[model samples]
Target: MSDSDPVKGKYAAFFRGCPVEAELLLSDIDSERIFDSIADALTETGYIVLPAALPLGISDALFTRIASFEDDVFRPAGVGRAAEFQLNPFVRNDEIRWLSSGDEVEAQYLAWMEKLRVGLNRRLFMGLFDYECHFARYMPGAFYKKHVDAFKGRTNRVLSTVFYLNPNWAVDDGGHLVMYEDSVEPIAKISPLMGTLVVFLSDRFPHEVTTASRLRYSIAGWFRVNTNLGPHIDPPQ
Candidate 1:
């Protein structure tokens, strides 16, 4: 995970012209400081928004991987999971492809998140067991209405993460993630800009994705704690 490391050559080319491109590895960057900031933010505020948080090497690879996918590879995103799953266009109108280790780029992203999971557990003792995420694509005009990622006791998801991949996003591009508090006024209106990572307590925030004026891409995921349901220990799906 260094500049001279063999693995760096494979993904480094992708970052050449990107605005946030720094070809930084987790080791090259101040990962410890980043982790500390995330922990402190979660303890004081329910959410944290970070700009250019991901190392450029992996971020570029992720952008390329998602951009290469064909339309057929993505399915309509749905509500709920397992037996309760259903496509509710009124609630969410995006497309998705679940992330898996089968692909190198996706695996790299997952590995990066693993570092986060472990770091947070050590700092906040959040008991995060694992993570699952998907590549979400919102074409022009797509939107997801206000909703919480999880309910306190009804789900295992404890933290939610959104990492954006849209470069040079304009202020009026319209794809802002509006986060609300108890009184209905928004606490933040986050732009889905490149390399911006948002982390929040899943059950404590209500958020919605405003309609996008152009195509949008992001990796949205959750850190889940182990929950038992007879023989099953995770998502029943």
Candidate 2:
């Protein structure tokens, strides 16, 4: 509200003195521009990166919440459908816990994602019906092998998203997401920096998480179409 408040909120250097209420910096995103960019990228290369997608306040709060959790709160991430799911550290060594509409910050983030889903659907006619996400933590020396988020003719996951929460990430941090646009080379190598958001076609991009020297945090999610019916569901995962 005050000029001083904005200055203090912007520089978050002294967390002990700055009030939490002052940190709720609402997003000032241009919806039309953002969705248009996303659509264009999807049409061209099948992915897009939106730096500082969420306001610094929301991203900071979400990161704090995830960092405050106990080690047991996250389970070793696995792959495949319900019964077919198995833990194979060689594939992905990170730990994860699905996000739910409980805490205030979590609710706000989910609502924002819903708005994104609706906006993209309207502009790009993506037919996105729902969104799901989980908080993931990769410990030191952990990594995920190159893989696609969705398989052809098998799942309803249409879009994949990754929002990074690690602050002050350095070039040597080693947790870069390398996405392959072609068979022989990568199109992008992204750092898991604070407030960064990456969205890509689930089945189009082949990506992998390189080893991290220190702990890394992020929220990985997907947008899906309604494929469930009376007696059967598309995917039980």
Candidate 3:
């Protein structure tokens, strides 16, 4: 569409005049390009990792806020949902605190993810209906065994997204996210570096976190379709 087209012109004006959320998204052309790249990568492979995908300031603020949370605020990472949910440290040895719009960084990050959800839907026609995420901390020696985020036709979580929060991370840190294909060999090993974002098809790739020698921090999230089963819902609990 030409810039002079009335509909296109109206959107251009609206982009400039919209609120903070729109301003944060529409004003950053690079982010749009990044989203396109992410979509393309997911289509080509099952996953993609982008370094420095998020604004540095937002990543810093989120890391700081999560670090400040009281010890009790985080619960042992578990598998399953609601009644079936139970702590399974053998599978994953980490702690988690769910994300909410309770703080400035949390709110900003949610807004950012919302913008991403919209962008992905527009580009790929994924019908992503909602998103939910949590702040996760992996203490020394913590690790998660290989697993897929969702079961095909049993869950609505279609896409998984992870944002790392550890700056100055090293290869020795050992908390690399290892993704596997059909074979035993891993296809990708990703470091938990600050501002790095990873996106993937939830049920297509099996992945794990290697044991970390030091504290590891990240935001793990999913974009879900609105599929209902009886009175039960996706996201389980």
Who wins the lDDT comparison? Answer: 1
Off by over 4 Å in 3: 1-22, 229-237
Point out the worst 10-residue segment of candidate 3 by lDDT.
1-10
Candidate 2 wrong stretches, greater than 4 Å: 1-29, 228-236
Candidate 1 segments exceeding 4 Å error: 1-29, 229-232
Per-residue CA lDDT of model 1 for 109-144, tens digit only, reads 775677688789999999887789999999999999
Score residue 210 of candidate 1 by CA lDDT: 96
What's the CA error at residue 67 for candidate 3, in Å? 1.4
lDDT of 2 by residue, 151-174 (tens): 876889989999999999998999
Each candidate: what lDDT?
0.85, 0.82, 0.84
- Model 2's TM-score against the true structure: 0.85
Q: Which model, 2 or 3, shows the larger TM-score? A: 3
lDDT of 3 at 159: 96
